[model samples]
Target: MWLLFLLVAAVAAVFSCARVCRAAVAAARTGRPARPPAPAPAPDPAGDDGHAPGLTLYEMAYLSGGPQRLADVVLVLMAQKRRLLLAHTGWATVVEPVAQDPVERATLSAIGPDGQRPIPAVREALVADEAVRAVADKLVADGLALPAAARPGIRSGIRQVWAAALLVVLTAAAAYWMAPPGTDTALLLGWFSLPLVLCLGTLAVARFELHPYRDWATDEGEQRLPGKADPPGSRLPSAPLAPLTSLISLALHGPSALTDPALRAALHSSGA
Candidate 1:
């Protein structure tokens, strides 16, 4: 009966909205930053510790910005260091053949085998690169980031609600059209409205974190994200902010944090 179908749709919507709300709560739980730790002991000489004492620039970027932001951080730093040439017009050229780290190597590799590619192309390529994914995987392994499978996508969640709404509408229409004479189809329609009301209420109450932050870092991890930025009016060449340390600023504030006009223009245009 149409009433039954409406009830089923209502249940489906409730489940979907519940899932979305749970994700939002989980994100909120992880949204708090971890407290700063006491002084650390001497470093392990064999390079066996998983993550370094505090946090690496790569890890910081991953925590604050997710994969795409991490990639953008690397590209902007490389351009600042002159390891690569990134033009405001959206082209990238590899200036230095050697990469200092895995993340840099990944960026360079994403530029393609020929060492040249459009800035946007390279940005996209680097985001999906295995190397970048590896960084996210490591964070997840350390409990700093949510795993890919568990990441909450608000759009997808809303889509499920939409499907439920559609099902309810179709069922209600069918029940009305197929009713025998004097079957009281008006009452049937009113019953169906209950499920629709349920769906609408679920949507009204649900909440989720915005993208990237919720997509990546856990509460503990978010706590570790750097709160500093380059002091205003700071410029490059003198390296007012060390290049590696500066990645923190770039990660936190994005391309606008870069003191170099050309670097900001290039990466910003690349959709970083």
Candidate 2:
């Protein structure tokens, strides 16, 4: 009975591992840039408010930095406007009852009705805020962000590798049980080493390939946003508006893209 179980488990492990390997490969292929560049999107007409209609600060942040970037921008704006005080310990305290803009208002709302909250909690709150949702919806509509369904499918495929690993363990256990008395259990476990190694290798490759796409933006957003220049006057050295452009730059290029060391430290400290 143990021998039959071992054989069946071995077969199952092989099948599951093969599926996982295929998924890893597919993910890697998707991670690569597509050939024959896509045409640039037509520019949206400017709104009377001086910004493009339907393009919110949240969307810009999402395109550049993902959700954390959005939170970082909000928190920075709040701190700059003196609406909130952020400490190196990850605590945020509200100093002003009013917000300067929609993004700032969303941050204040995420900090909750109370005057104080942990930075992480505030970030989580911002993710669920209406402004964030609106920006995400707009991005999805504009094809700048992937639909919500796309992310879950990729994540589910990645999770299957761990499930396959469990099957490998079961195969080993069954093999050990079927072995004769005094037989080396290590040799039975060794039968699984190849599958284990393959599974781990697939995971590593997937992680490397998928890291850039793990955020909200789709291929379209990734191709277009990074090349955009910082708006005039927004890049000035030691300017009060420096944080605003810095936040946008951080979104486009990553945390290291920030010109201001203090802003980078603040983002790191806030877990943004």
Candidate 3:
């Protein structure tokens, strides 16, 4: 009876691991390339508007650094425009009551009637915020961010791994119950080994396969806007409006790209 239970448990474990492995392999097979080709530049309509022809600052931030990055850019812009003050300790203070956009308004609301709050707390408050959601929806509609339906097959694989772990626990309990008094240690150890290996193996494979799909943009989004998806290098704009353009680049690429050392120092001092 003990041997039968052990065999059944081993089969169950193998089946669960196999399911996860297959999902992982499938995700890899359909995964996006590490470096997709640059897309042809689209013509820009002449304007001083912060948004480019095909992409907005929010979209660029999403492509490069996700929602949190978008939030960071909003905060940076607010500080640069002298509408907000950021302390080195991560607290933010509203200096201006006005907001330039919905995202800006949402960010201000997150800071609350107190007129000041920690950056992390503000970020948390904005996670489910309607204004943030509106920005994300626009990005998706504009082909800059991935739609929810197109995400990688991670949920099922995760469920399988948990199920396999439960099976391992149940198998161990059965083994203990069926073992005779003063059973040899080696026999018990051998009985548990297969299920343990299967559980660990499933988790490892899930992590490997699901890692690449963790980005905010999907394979389709990456392919469509390859240039915008990466950190700006030689691709940085040099027009008369370079200062405004650079802000977009900084939002996507990060503060290190700022030409103004003083501005960079100020941004870094905020501890963002």
Candidate 4:
């Protein structure tokens, strides 16, 4: 009877989980299917190219706790002439403008050398600049630009380990107080299997994005006019040398310098 009860509970749990996952995915994709892969130099309307050279970056943050912690992503793109920030709700028609900031004349003067060059062209030039590429490669190697999964896994894994340790204690206590014969072995099995189940379940239902980039806020704040005291704890979120060098090169030489087709395609897709 106990075995039958456990089996029925397991089946019910699996069915419930499946229903929840399906509903979530349906809600996310309710509008149109995702747009086709955006090509480099995305189709541009006439009269949109007279602005200064622009570099736009996006960042998204997410959390996992069953379905309750899921949040729609917000995207913020900042560039030389203007900034466009927006969020997409679950439905197709739910896009909303978060804010837009026009560049000041002084800032524009500082950024200088306007262009219609595509972003891919810039990425290519950066990669080809032996001096720049060497710095970027070193930054990537030193964990500044590596994928986000590695560090988060260590942090979240520690949380799971602590939770599992507590669950084992609770399960043992309950079994000792009231479970029937052979329940000790069952409790041991549960202790060993429970964390695996919880971790996989969290992952299955979580909103996951690969290679999430950190915010540039830290780096921006650290930059001084070459003679100021270094701000405390002000470190670039990325490998300090490469991102700074690249941005400086772009700022100085303009977007004509680098050209990476893949990067171009991605920025174009983003409408950056």
By lDDT, the best candidate is 1
Candidate 3 Cα errors over 4 Å, as ranges: 1-53, 140-212, 226-232, 238-246, 253-272
The alpha-carbon lDDT assigned to residue 22 of candidate 3 equals 69
Reference-based lDDT, each prediction: 0.67, 0.63, 0.65, 0.29
- Report the number of clashing residue pairs per model: 3, 1, 0, 13
Better model by TM-score: candidate 1 vs candidate 2: 1
* Per-residue lDDT of candidate 1, residues 114-228 (tens digit): 9889988887888888888887776675667766655655546756766777777888888888777887877888877876776666566543334443347775666655452
Candidate 2 clashes between residue pairs 3 or more apart in a chain or in different chains:
64-251
Who wins the TM-score comparison?
Answer: 1
Q: What is the lDDT of residue 90 in candidate 2?
A: 74
Candidate 4 structure quality by residue, lDDT tens digits, 1-272: 33443443344444444544453343223212233312223222210121211111111011110001001111111231133212122111112222232212212222224422233333333224343333323323322232223334433443443454455444445444555776656555564354447435644434242212121111221121121132311322235344333333222222222133432233435333
Better of 3 and 4 by TM-score: 3
State the TM-score for model 1: 0.66
TM-score of every candidate: 0.66, 0.60, 0.58, 0.26
lDDT per residue for candidate 2 within 195-246, as digits (tens), equals 7776667678768765434566666655545354554324333455455555
What lDDT, from 0 to 1, does candidate 4 have?
0.29
Clashing pairs in 1: 30-219, 33-223, 34-223
| Cα-based lDDT at residue 268, candidate 4 | 39
